[model samples]
Target: MAKGAAKGPTVASLKKVTPENLASLGVERLAELLVSVAETRPDLKRRLRMELAANQGPEHLAAEIDKRLGSLQTSRGHVVWRQKPAFVRDLDALRRLIAERLTELDPAAALDRLWLFLQTAQPVARRFRDRDRDGAVAAAYVRAAADLGRLLADQDPHLAANALIDAVAADPEPWAVWAPETLRESSAAMAAVALKAARGRLGGAAPSLAVVRALAQAAGDLDALRGSWSLQALANPSVAAALAPQFLAAGRVGEAGEILRAAAPQPTGPSGRLPPPDFAWESAWIDYLDQAGETAAAQDVRWASFERTLDVDRARSFTTRLADFDDVEAEGRAFAYAAAHTDFERGLGFLMAWPALAEAARMIAARPDDLDIDPAQAELWAAQLRRRFPAAAHRLLRAAAAAAFRRREFKLCDRLTEEADTIIL
Candidate 1:
């Protein structure tokens, strides 16, 4: 920087740079010095850069050159304007010049400055694109766009997010393709920006559906992009109104349901209570339940429009999921859940674990003398239940039904009789 420039840093300088000297240099000088050593002694520069970054964050350079130049007073009136660099007019100009010089030779330094510029200075991503289509801007934005795609996999979008996306798409590389590939600790912000862009294309006013589809394809996960779009629409009201119907029309009924469910306001404090339910909220809930295939739950809510509400169907659905559980204990628990509710009279219908449940004829003869079966027998039953779920072993349950029938215990007999064809797993 003083006159003669070295393409590679001096080995002696690498060895000579002590912590004390590093501490004494101005922030700008310190950054430049770090750059000088970066090419030849990259490992050491990396360690020092990380150290400086951890110890002194962005605030360290907030005052910058303007504040530094304040020290330039003179004894004589004609202030010999000799030593100051010609372009030290302001901090902005100085920062820009320093950044330019950094990108010219220092790869590490360029990356660091580029990160800062994109995050804090001015979204230099689009600016970089405008400035140079094929220079560092090309590779940098490609990486940025890719990283942003990973980010969209997580969050909502901003107003400026669309503009940023337009700029990214204006270039050759697609954001989704790079997101999974470009994602890294050093480039996380860029990834987040890209994700924000994905939200714009999917949720808002109909942009090219093809672009969003391509984004999904590039990210290699359509469901995740839809999830991100849902979140963004929920947070932004204008976004919600404009985009909700479009999302529904996109055959994302389930996703739209999730968004509205997530948006349904909840009471904040324990001391206070939510207002009495209105028709709108009930309708929204019913919409969510229906889309999610909780028909029983939706039906119960709908019953409020007429008379007494019985959640029998929802209870049955719950029973079904419970019986479908993998273990004997889990199946027993489902009965317990049914016990507290009306739909089931604490039915043992979920008990599919009896060994004979796999063989209809064996089940008829195997009725326990003591209703309270042994733990070992229960374990055996558990295994049988698992097999029943997978192998469709209806014979054991049929046998149990016949035994119950001969004993004049019709209810118990019917409980063992399963109609697997009737249930939709």
Candidate 2:
């Protein structure tokens, strides 16, 4: 055996304990051993119960599940983060039990059970109050519901669509409303499956506008999909954006554009001041423009969006589009515009990504002395500069080291000092 290896029963030794041996251990001893095992591995107990339930009919298994679910203390009120493990395990176990039971029922029957599980599970999952974990639990139930929806769709799409529509249209309880994004995504996936099935059944006939509206309504909010559109739908750009692709795919390009445009940030809201522009909606609109064969309009949108946000990736994308156009003059003009108007950090990134190293160095040198820059970012720029602009690299590193020392960041100061010395050498 290797050093520090644990000594315990080997596989061969454990294999000696057969069912016969277990049976021979009198009921009391066996029960004690089972309790000990269950105490050590709670999952084993759940599995054991599920295994026992497997032999019974679906009704028995469901009853067992309900009993377990009922026993869970979901109303413990403001669970400490430290106690999340027990709650997570309980919910996960219930989810597994529900999934296992789902496998035994026919599609329609399974859908009913899944719907019930979702209705019950939503409030229970929300009890955690932690957004991330709550979302995760909600996502798990959504996945379960989606899986059932797919199964039903495979058997009978119309039936699946109806069931899914009804589930989504059902008003959410107060607690269930907290995790709307998860619910929306899961419901949307099911709706997509339903729509695909319905389309296939229709066999090339355009789905009636009513059918489209019904599917969209299943996503819980239908203002964007209603026959009459609403500006308030823009408040949830994701919802509006989600509907746009469906419209675009259906060749309703004008309607899609309307949806996106309405969702764009207006100068004023009912309360007076409009909220910030939703980048998601803006990006979606740019995509729509490109798809509509309005290349110049798309480019304008991209540049305008980038200017408004200074989003680095957006800037890079605009520059890439210019490069693709083979317009070197345009690219240079864009770079000059960015350097003059954009923040130094964003401009530096844009120029570096453009591999306009010379321009980047000039920009770094020209930045005002009192302007704050992240030390880590400065180090990165310094390293990049070292390859082509040694003097600039050395200056950046010295400044970074001095700043680190002033901030009492001795380790970073030492590292920067060493790097500066290497540049000098």
Root-mean-square deviation per candidate: 22.7, 8.6
Error of 1 at 235 (Å): 28
Q: In model 2, which regions exceed 4 Å deviation?
A: 1-36, 55-60, 72-81, 100-112, 122-136, 154-214, 217-245, 260-278, 291-293, 304-325, 353-355, 366-371, 383-392, 405-415, 422-425
- Clash count, one per candidate: 17, 0
Q: Model 2 Cα displacement at 204 (Å)?
A: 33
Scored by CA lDDT, what does every candidate get? 0.42, 0.63
lDDT per residue for candidate 2 within 1-425, as digits (tens), equals: 99999998677865587886578678999888887898877666876776577577666666666666555434545556776666566666666566555455534444555556666664565556675445555656656554554445445445655565444435323213322332233445555555554433422212333344444455433442544234564446785677777677767788778788777776675787866667877777887898789988988878787776666667666767775556576567667766775476777777777677887777767775733557888788888889789877777788888889999999999998898899853
Candidate 1 local lDDT, 327-361, one digit each (tens) = 34533443344333332211222223221243322
Q: In model 2, where is the ten-residue run with the lowest total lDDT?
A: 174-183
Q: How much does candidate 2 score in TM-score?
A: 0.65
